[model samples]
Target chain A: MKYVITLLVGMVTGAVAFVLLLYYNPFVGNQSVSPLAVSELDLVDFSYSLLASDSIVFTNDGESHMQPHPAKVLQLWEPTVKMTRALVTILNDSRGQPAGLGVKFSSDSEKTRLINAEVVVDSVWHIYSPEHGTFFVDQTENFWPYLHDIVVPARLSGGDSWRGSWYGITSTGPGALGIARVTGGAGDFADTEGEAVESIAARAYSAITGPVAMTGKLTIALPRQEALP
Target chain B: MLKIFYLGIVMGIAAAAALVYIYPVVDQHREPSLITVRPNGGNSESFHIRLPGDRIMAGVTGSTELTPLALEWPEHDFLANMQTELFKVRNENDVVIGAASRMSGWSEQHGSFVEWVVHLPARGSMFMTMAAKPSADGYREGKLRAGTREFLTLNGTVIERFVNEADDSDSDNVGRIELVTALVGLPDELE
Candidate 1:
């Protein structure tokens, strides 16, 4: 009976601790990470290519998997819905130091038509690498869904940031041109307007989600920033 | 009896820990409510869940609170300033099924834009981009732009409402997210 009493007391204490930790913990709050300011620049242009090998694809009835860099084709059969989230590597042909672009889009069952698409271009944050890989602190880590506080591979810095909606066809073998319009942005991209013209390549002769490749040019005109005193 | 007190305490603590761990497991396995409503002869499925819990934003993990923002000048840290709020997607029955992320900002190009993504476990994910801003009553509504897997064939709208009631016990901002999806040509037997 004495042991039972002690056990009951300990249990109550544990419950209280759990409640406090769940409710009153001080670590519960929101914080934002800021980017650096940029110099005077009006027009910024850069190009990017899709890293098909490093692309991660998900489907409802089809297979969901990730193909590392150099992966050419992502295959799915009879898929009703498919989504591909891939990192587009910034090419070296930008007039100014090019930050980079991130692209994600979902496709219809045929995998040849694009449904919903979006792109983000930022000067600081990136998940691309030069040696055919992503920017995970651990090179082995390839997925982004479960990752947070990722390493900022400040590949290019000019305080340029933009997010926009993209539309186009996901056809294989020199696919149709897709375009993205700048909808919102910050820094050098603030008050700016532009569009991205993209073309995709795949080994499949027809509409198939296999062996994908892409390249695009991003051109945005930045508004003049008032010189700070 | 005195000697058993220490053992009792240890056993009690273990029991409490076990209970806490079991709660979520049971919650996760509970049958998800898949409510289907046909409006105008189209298959419409609605999911309503209160998202009054923790959030991981820009690497900061903590309980979420509805802190009003001052949308004035541009924030130098654009990524952080986007306030990419990420939360777990729970069903109306409070079953943890998936996760979601939402961010809203203003720019000269577009007055105000909101981007939100919802990922359903093994079911695929969907994205919604809305031009509408939140109202004084604390709700933002928009149409579903794109989706994958089960969300692909459906065209619908998502409304997120925030409930700010003063609870003396908990000092965090509690809110609810409602996803009302109207699927076109969705086979009734499709899961």
Candidate 2:
């Protein structure tokens, strides 16, 4: 009778313990909620510049793809479409410090005389170091020069806190000038609307030797955070 | 008193260990199901994905689920449904080849701008920029603008289709995306 009672007690104690363990399981709770709050900056106004050599122009004019066009602005006879992708430096009041990375892809068509530009910016400058090159903020790897591999992963891994996308529109001409607006964004620039004016410097377009000097001012209006009750 | 305390501790420890061992086995059965990629043949492949919940959509950068963002201007008469999404790309064999970004938007000034950037690691990346509008059947067709490396000189057209209304309650199926790529330019060896 004592053995039976002891066995019952053990079984009951074990079942209660198991239920408690299940109730407080560490892995079962909600992990999707981000710990970081959105930035409080109401308006972010910044300027950015892209050097000519930093941009690559891929044309469908049947020209040799290997031919070097470092300036990125190409002159073609046929009604061709050119896809240009550039890595630009985001600046603050023309100052280099606290600068960040910008990746812009523009598709220009001579046939339609239209240009569509998609720009992705990481304003905090998470993974890019001008002197030591590109390295992870966590210091996992050595200085890697490839911005293509670094930018996407940095954006994906949530290391890029100040990130957004601004879609721009421009027309094709001898000396082209265009404007852009905030189409969509994430992070600090979420629910934001702003305007930016982009223009190619006269010298960059006229001379093939000079780099494509692009200057633009971006004014983004961040949404106000709701007050907690 | 000491014996009872020791016995309770021992039972608690044993029960915790047993629960840890059994939890995974039970939890595996409760996880959401996933479907395989179904091929439509002739250069077209279709993918089935779950419709992510609102929590996943609101948190853009870090959410584990694939989130599509509305990228349209509110005031403009631009098509109401401008969106952009980035997700993993799989080949016909359903092996994850790389990642691709898709942006679909339309404006009265620009007409329709649908672009896909497919980045294949080590091999190269392809940019397919289509000016064409979606058909009545809801599929958009566009020409390949440019490529790098292996796809450098290839000319192709991609047909994209988003099929079926997602039945969120259905475990077997949720949604589907179909992509058909027809290439025109290839080297003699590849041809």
Candidate 3:
């Protein structure tokens, strides 16, 4: 009877300890909630330059001996586009695991852009856009340099502030490619620097051509939870 | 005593599993930061400029001949213009002090080419030039010159010539000129 009582007491103690350990396990709580729990995302304000030549000069010889012919100037429309706020929705795969994010742009009158999430060999999350290609999110820096994509930490609670820097070229555009790099948060941008080079045809047409440069600040504010519908 | 020992072993295994789950030890794969120079707007011919670390300068430049037209143009009066096109200069802190796309054109007379001189704030200066001409074998021969003049506050000028080449078309002639220079100094923070 003494031995049986001792075994029973040991079993009870072990079972209680096991239960406590299971309850306190941090990994089992929420993996998906920590990264993408935000209801709304603030807009990424971008300031860039649009460079083009007004006229062109073509000479037959390298000298003034031949009459210089003027080439036509190419026109540019809507040189700049500002990315507005987006509604964030978590997307789950067939296994009910967090797969990607479905973002609907507010400025485009509810046009949604799907961002596919991938875990490469590094075990870091890389977000992909069809238009912009794949880019890794530097959680430490809170910015992606290749794509110039910036975001406020979704895990931040109300009134929390964060900042980051980004620099790179846009993958696709209409005119000559523009290079841009910006650092800021909310409605404000700091050290915003970029240049838009004239297209090849435009450059060849206009003997004199250069890039249009721009520098400015951008500022943004996160809407409190109470403001969300 | 036996039960307690078994329970302890089980608890140890569980604890190890939890630790791994909470803080995973993963081998992160990080790609080196690459500064790419794309000349003639062609991605295929673009080359990467190496930036080893802070206070280091590195670059790569190449020139190639395009297909020559069947007709022969005057040798002395041939018009060829080569420009730096675009460049970004960064200091030790990886902050850009000056960035621009300056265009300069000149007729290809004997040994005539456009030269670009850029001054990077609190760092140093860079000089670059590109020149090309048609060879006797109906192929183009080109030359590229690029160098850096670094000014250290305490130290004198540190001049480094990165690329200087003059070759025929049979060599690696990829008709492009790029100069990348990084000077070492603590300049005022870029506003």
User: lDDT of each structure?
Assistant: 0.37, 0.36, 0.24
DockQ, prediction 3: 0.03
Each prediction's number of clashing residue pairs = 13, 1, 15
The candidate scoring highest on DockQ is 1
- In model 1, where do residues sit more than 4 Å from their true spots? A1-229, B1-33, B46-52, B58-81, B135-138, B186-191
- Which of candidates 1 and 3 reaches a greater TM-score? 1
Q: What DockQ, on C-alphas, does every prediction get?
A: 0.08, 0.03, 0.03
Question: Which pairs in model 2 have colliding backbones?
Answer: A52-A212
* Model 1 lDDT, residue A175, Cα: 11
Model 2: per-residue lDDT, tens digit, A55-134?
22211123422232232222222211112222223334445343333333332211220011112111111112121111
Task: Write one digit per residue (lDDT tens) for candidate 1, span B1-191.
Answer: 65566555566556666765543321112244476667565555555445344332222113143221211111233222233344445555556555455655443433445666665533545666554567677677776655544665666666666555547686664555666665564455345
What lDDT tens digits, residue by residue, belong to model 1 across residues A120-149? 111111222111111111001111110111
Worst 10 residues of 2 chain A by lDDT: A135-144
Q: Write the per-residue lDDT of candidate 3 for residues A1-229, one digit (tens) a residue.
A: 7656665666556556654454344443211111112324332222211221111111111232213222211111111101111111222333443332221111111111111111111001111112111111111111122111222231232423223332322221111221111111111111121221111111111112212131211111223334433
Q: Give model 2's TM-score versus the native structure.
A: 0.33
Kindly report which residue stretches of model 2 are placed more than 4 angstroms away from their true locations once superposed.
A1-229, B1-82, B107-109, B165-173, B186-191
